[model samples]
Target: MNRRTLLTAAATGVAAASLPSMAAASPAMTVKDTMNRTALYRSSARTQLAALRWGSTTARGLLEQVLAHQAEVNPGVNALATLDVAGARAAANRADQYLARTGRTLGPLHGLPMTVKDALETAGLRTTCGSPDLADHVPGKDADVIALLRQAGAVIVGKSNVPPLCQDLQTSNPIFGTTSNPFSPAHTAGGSSGGPAAAVATGMSALEVGSDLAGSLRLPAAYCGVYALRTSRGSSPIVPTRGHIPRPPGWLTSSDMLTLGPIARDADDLDLLLDVLAAPAPADRRAWRIDLPEPVSRTLDGQRIGVWADDAYCRVDTSTRDVLEQVTREVRAAGAVLDESSRPVDFAASNILFQKLMYATSAATAPDAVFQGEVKAADAVTEDSPSALYLKSRTMRHRDWAKADEERQKLRAAWDAYFETHDLLITPAAPTAAVPDQSSVPAPERYITVDGVRRSFYDQTSWINLASPVGLPSLVMPAGKTRDGLPLAIQIIGPYLADRSVIAAAKALAKLLPTPPKAPGLMA
Candidate 1:
C-alpha cells in the first residue's frame, strides 16, 4: 500500500475507536462527537500520527487530548513521575508549523506524544527513577535513546514511575509512591517498567521507552495487556551507551542482560519505534549503521513454530496455562507446523546462570562496605542458607564470573541451534496476570501465590529469564484475560538479531487473539 493508503487504513480500520470522534474544534462536531473525542486519546500512536498527516488534527491538539486524559486518570493510576507540559506544547506547536510550511513530516513519529521510563534520563526533565536521593536530579542532556526519540519527532511529555534503582518487580518508591494496576487498583502493576505499561494501557501516552533485564519490560506489558519488545543485542548495540540508572549518571558500563526497548498498545507501534531506535549510540554512529533484517515469515501458514508452554521447574497458573494452550491450538489451526516437545535449553540451569551473571554485573555499583559485608556473609553462610546464592553471586571472584559468562555463550549456541529448524518459540510472559499489590511489603519478603500455594517472588520472572541471558529478541503481546478479568499475555522469542521476526509473529497472532480489555473505570 502507498503511504496515504496506509494512513487511511490506520485511520479507518486499526483505529475504529478514533473514527467515532472528530476534532474537538470542528464546527461540524456534535455533542456526542466531542464527548467521544476523549477516547481518541486512547487511539494507537500510528492512528494519531495518521490523523495528523491527513490534516484531521494538529500536534498541539493531540498533546492537549493526552494531557487532559492523563490529568483525569493519573491521580488514581500514579503512572507519570514528571510532566513537561510547557515544553511538550511548545514542541507540538513547532511540529504543526513545520508540517504546515514544509508539507513533510519531521520523521516517522512526527508530533507523537509519549512518556519515557524514569530510568532513562531526559534533558531538563527530572528523572528520579523513583528514588528519594535523586528527587531533585535533572540532566542537562538527553540519553542517547531519548535523543534518538526526539530526532524521530516524538515529544517527551514526561517520565513514568519505576522501582527504586529499577530493582524490584513491583513499581514503588519514596518519590512517586506506588503505581496501581489500571485494571484494579487493588493489584500491583508489575515492574520495573510498570508505570510505562500502565500509562500505555490507560492512554496516558501513545508509546514509551522502557528497559528490561530479567522481565522488567515484558512482565508489565503482560500484566497491563500491552506490547513491548526487548530488542536483541548482537554485533550492533540496540540500547543507549550510557545515561541509564543503576550505573549512576555518566557511567558507560551496564549489565550485559540489560536492554532498552519500546512499549506501546500494539505491535505496529512497536515496529514504528524500533525503526527509529535500532541505530548505534552517538559516539559510534559515524562508524556503525544498523539495518536489522526483515521478518522471517509474514504469516503463520507454513511457519515452523515451537511451543514451550509450561515447564516443570517453574509452572504457570491454570489461567496462564489455558491461554498458552489456546494460542498453540490457534497456531496449529492456522497451518503452522508446531513442535511441542523441543526444549531449547535447560530452564533450571539457564536461570541459575542468569541470576549469577545478573548479580555479578549489579555488584559494580555496590559500595565498598556492602561488598565487604557480602564477602563476610558468604564466608558465614551454609549452602542451606536462604541468602547463600545471592551472597556468593554478589561477591563472586573475577574467574567465577568469567566461567558464568562462558556458560551463557553455550546457552546462546543452544538457542541458535533450535532456531535453525524453528522460525519462532512461544511461551508465557509471566506465570499469571497482574499479581496482588505487594508494594507495601519489602522486596525479599515478597511472594506470589500460584495455585493457592506461595511461590518465590522472583519466580514472576522465571519464564522471562530464558530470553534475557541469551540476548534474543523477545516480544510480549496480550493473549487473553484471566477469569478474574485481568490481562494475560504470551512471549514470542526469535533468533539473535532477528527482532523483526518476533514482531511479525506478534502482528499475525494479534489477529487470532482477543483484543485485551481496557482498564475498568479509567478506560471506560
Candidate 2:
C-alpha cells in the first residue's frame, strides 16, 4: 500500500482493543529461583551474553528472568505494551540448541532478551505507535534495525509504549495509557521513547533501541536515570521515524534530523550496542562504509571540555545547575582543561532555525485540513511573533524551506569550526528532573517552573536543540539527583560523527560521580 492510503486506512481502522488476537501459545518454561533471577537481572548485557556462551545460563533462563521481572513491575509503570511470551521462549530454545550443538555463540547479543520501542515495526507482532489508527497493524517484516538485532542473536520479547503518533513529551496514549517514571509514579517517564528507558531502568529488559528527534531519547534516559545515545545523523541505517507511524506505512524517508540509537543502563552497553548498529544499509554498503574515529583522550587528564550549565535564553532549575557545577569542579580537579565561557554559534539564532526545521518536518504528517487551518492562522498573525513563526513554518512554501536550509548549513559550519578545539560540550538535558505527569492537559497549556519562573511548555527542548539540527553525536548519563531524590542528567555533545569520543567521556565521568541507584522495588 502507498503511504497516503495506509494513513487513510489507519484513520478509519477499528480500535486496538477490539482487534483479533494474533499471538500464539507455547509450552510454559519452568521459572528459575529468586537468586538466579536477581543475578541475571542485575548483570549487564555483556555479562549475560558471556554466561549464555559458557553454558552457565541458558537463553531460556534469561528470557524467564526478564518475564518474571516484567510481571513484578510493569503493572505500576505500564512500560511494555505487548509481550510476545510464546515467540520469545521459542527463539531462546533454538539459540540454546544451536550453542550446545556447535559449541560456539551465535553473535554479539547471543541469548540476550531485549525490548524495542513500539514506534519501530516488528514482524508478526502488533507494532502500534500508541495510536488507535495502527493499533491492530502488524508488519510482515522487521524494521532495518530490528532485523539487525535479531541477526546479532538478540531475542525480542515485546514492544514498549509510546505517545500517540509520538508527538508529545510524555508517554501516554489511548492505546496503552501512561508510562510512569520508575523513580516516582506521579512523574512522567518522558517520550517518545519513555517505555524503553523505563524498561531498561527497571531491569525488565537488557537493552533497547530508541529514536530521537527532539530530546525523545535523551530526556527519557535522564528522567529514568539510564544512559541514552543520540547518534550522528545517518551513522546507522536504522530509519526509525520512517518505519514508525505519523509517516504511515510504505514511507521510506524520515525527518532530516531524526536518528536511531541505543538506551541502556551504562555507557559500556551503549558502546556495545553502537558497534552492532553503526553500519551502512545493504544498498549503501555496495559502494562505501562508515568507520568512526576513536576518542581523542581516554582519560579526563589533558582533555579539553566545554561546559554550558545555564543560558540566558533557557535557564535550568537550581538543582539541575548544581549537579552540572559539581561535574565541572570534579573534571577540573582531575586535570582536565575546562572552558566555561566558550560557546559554538549563536544559541538564539540556532534555536529559532531548529524550530523552523522541526515544525516544517512535522508538517508532512499533518492532515490536509489541519495544514489548511495552520495556513489560515499564519496569515492572521504578525510576521515576527512566535505563533506566527510556528504557523508559517508549519505551512511554509518551498522557497521558505530553501532559505531555512541555507541557514542550517551555516550553523553546521559554525559547529564544525568550534569542535576543532573542544573534545565535548556538556549541558543540562532538561530544565529539571521528571515533572508531574501532564498528559491530560493540552500541549499548548502545559508549563514548567524553573527557578521561580514560569516557562513555555516547549522549553524542555531548548538546550537539547543544540545538537539536533547539526546532527552532532550526543549522550545523556546520570550526573546526580535532586534534593527530592529524582534523577538529574547532563548531555555530552561531541563533534560530528565522534560517537566514540562521547561515550569515552561518559565512561570517565561515571567514575567520579555517584553510581545511579536502582529504582525502588525494581529488584525486590
- Model 2, residue pairs in steric clash: none
- Tens-place lDDT per residue, model 1, 354-444, is 9988888888988899889889999899999988888899998999988888898999999999999999999999998899988898667
Residue-pair clash count for candidate 1:
0
Candidate 1: worst 10 consecutive residues by lDDT?
Answer: 7-16
Over 192-239, each residue of candidate 2 has an lDDT whose tens digit, in order, gives: 899999999988887998888888888899999999999988433333
RMSD of each: 6.3, 7.1
Q: C-alpha displacement of 223 in model 2, angstroms? A: 0.5
TM-score, cand. 2: 0.92
Best by lDDT: 1
